[model samples]
Target: MTLTLPPAPHGGPRAGRHLVDAALWPDVARLPRASALRTAVARRIVERAVRRLPLRVRTPGAAAPALPRQPRGSADGLPTLILHDPGAFFRRIGADGLIGFGESYMAGEWDGDDLVGVLTVLAGHVDDLVPQALRRLRGAWVHRRPASDRNTVDGARRNVHRHYDLSNELFATFLDPTLTYSSAVFASLPAGAEDLSAAQHRKIDRLLDLAGTGPGTTLLEIGTGWGELAVRAARRGARVRTVTLSREQRDLALRRVAEAGLRDRVTVELCDYRRVDGTYDAVVSVEMIEAVGAAYWPAYFGALHRLLAPGGRAVLQAITMPHERMLHTARTHTWISKYVFPGGLVPSREAIARHSAAAGLSLVHDTGYGEHYAETLRLWRERFLGRSAEVSALGFDHVFRRMWELYLAYSEAGFRSRYLDVRQLVLTGRTTADRGTG
Candidate 1:
């Protein structure tokens, strides 16, 4: 049934209301609610997990018993989690597991002093949080992704618009002045030491360099992120064609290209990567592979293989997870999928190699910089928090703020704990014979 919400106050849906797709309504309506017994069990499991970690948990009342403390270390201090409403927190966890945990935070049931650090400890111990017997029955607890979230041509557009089109103004508030939205290749441990713009340029330059883009080089960018990469490539004397599903991004990118006086050199199209045509001397897509759900990984790689001219090289920056974890969570719907990026999955390094190889591309170079991503998220989260008033002025509510905070902090934790990574991959053409023999 269609959820006929009163149209949003503005032109588009509000921050948390993006799940307005009629096809997704049924799934939302059917979300499971935990029983009292299940809630009690979940509380015990959470308490057990908390006890094993180097974290501090404070309950609601002054007389309430707090969690055990950890010894001082080189780190700033022990991370702290304060459960403002312990009952709601555990009930949500029992109902939706991790997804509920995020909702509980958004509902102001809990908070963390060092959100990223606390989340990192939790991420590091994800495997041991639950007992072996319970782990085997994960299917009973975890919510599978609904079929409506699949990245079909039409579905992909909806998913992309849901996040990317949330308002360019909103993204600009957190992203660097350049509006680059992916991990930057920082020259230092902390991101802001050399300025984010320089680091972003370094990352883009590295990808272009690996693709051998130069004067008269024809470059095809699969994901046009505000035209930063295209502008940089055009400045390198390469004619660039970039594609994106975001109308907001395409319009802004075109204006940026025009402002740079590179309109003749750069073309930004509102199109999907799968539908892009014509061969190019080089291809570069930054951190886009993660959005191409695992079911479409083969098609995504095949598009790259089909789009490259003979001897042409392609460069991709991808966010990845361990193979086992990727496999285990590939179809599980979690907090990120529910509240932030929909219809996306982080691919594993092994999955990247296997899929790219099968698509007749040889992996020439691969580099992982997960720590850089951690630093990048820290910068973004801080910037976003600093501009909370502006974010609210733009129409997002308190719940939206908390949700975005959890999303960014949760992502940073994934990288900090080494549960996730960002990788730059360089691919070269392979002969049909080579693929067949392999």
Candidate 2:
């Protein structure tokens, strides 16, 4: 699987610089062909990658026809889009790999016209190249373990630390000031009309609306990031209690609550949701269900149901996939699970509905806002890129910057393309009185 860099078209030093890196150079130098033949092999690998993508993905729009030839020419004299040092990188990512490719991107061993697009293409056609069924079996075997309080708590903290603990300063560079880390809700708004901040505000408003929050109501938020919703609900006259695993989030959220003069009405706890025990008029969990593994969905939902008063309503915003079970070789899922969000798994809509029902909660309303999430990620990506220097200054090197960029952009594409979806579900206990349904 060795691949050597073809000599630059004109034998220029700059052209061969990418291949000179120690990590990749050995494989390139030992490639079993002359430079011309190696170039052809590289083109073939790229073509194979393209072919692995689903047909619809390869041709995103009707106007964009499928590329029939490899090494499509570039008018600007740029290098052809080939996986230089593919063998080395691929070997590094061998057998149940996801984070390695992201690291390689950071190391400048690969280049793409569009990294997000490349990921989307890869994800769409992932089944073609990978043994998905066997991979899932192996992953399940590897992850199978008796559940324990320590394991659950550790998993929760690991996820929180991976994403939320990346440094509040760095997060502020991309996320809105409110720091709502979940999907945003865009209601009655024109497509692409609202910015990330506005969209998140709308999402908070929507959650409050779903919960019927108002004067004299007591609300509880699980996995409350930055406490924006808690503060907002409290301002609306509802007493809010929020739980979070990230110390950073709890600290910032508490400060925000104090600054807003709602400290009396809002309380942020640095603890796992499973440890919290209280009844509220409304209970909301945003973007946290994914961290509750599929094996624990029943218990997770039951906890949510128990936290709500008999007549209380609960709203949840979570990412959902189309499959009945989790995919194994899903590179995006794998990447997030390993590097971005440890122990995260996107449940399918059926799984959520069934689990809610099993927990004595009726799904009164379910709305798909997957595209809005795509839009939200796009805004975050742009903002992150705009603040690249600031992010780099926060102890993140070039590789870290590329990782975050790829994360934001490819996430956006996944949501937009319907490969991933976000759903806001309004659940009410069976004993709850029916309110005006939306």
Which prediction has the highest lDDT against the true structure?
A: 1
For every model shown, what is its TM-score relative to the native structure?
0.90, 0.78
TM accuracy, model 1:
0.90
Quote the lDDT for 88 in model 1.
62
- Candidate 2 residue spans exceeding 4 A from truth: 1-49, 52-82, 93-97, 129-151, 187-193, 324-333, 430-438
In angstroms, give how far residue 309 of model 1 lies from its true place. 0.7
lDDT by residue (100-198, candidate 2, tens digit) is 455545445456666566666565545554444444444421222223312276766876676788798998998888887777766544445656677
Give the clashing residue pairs of candidate 1, or none: none
Each model's total of backbone clashes: 0, 0
Regions of model 1 farther than 4 Å from truth: 1-32, 64-66, 69-76, 430-438
**All-Cα superposition RMSD per candidate:** 7.7, 7.6
Q: Model 1 clash tally?
A: 0
Residue-level lDDT of model 1, residues 91-199, one tens digit each, is: 6788888888887777666789889988999999889999887887677668899898999999999999999998999999899989999998899896546898899
TM-score of 2: 0.78
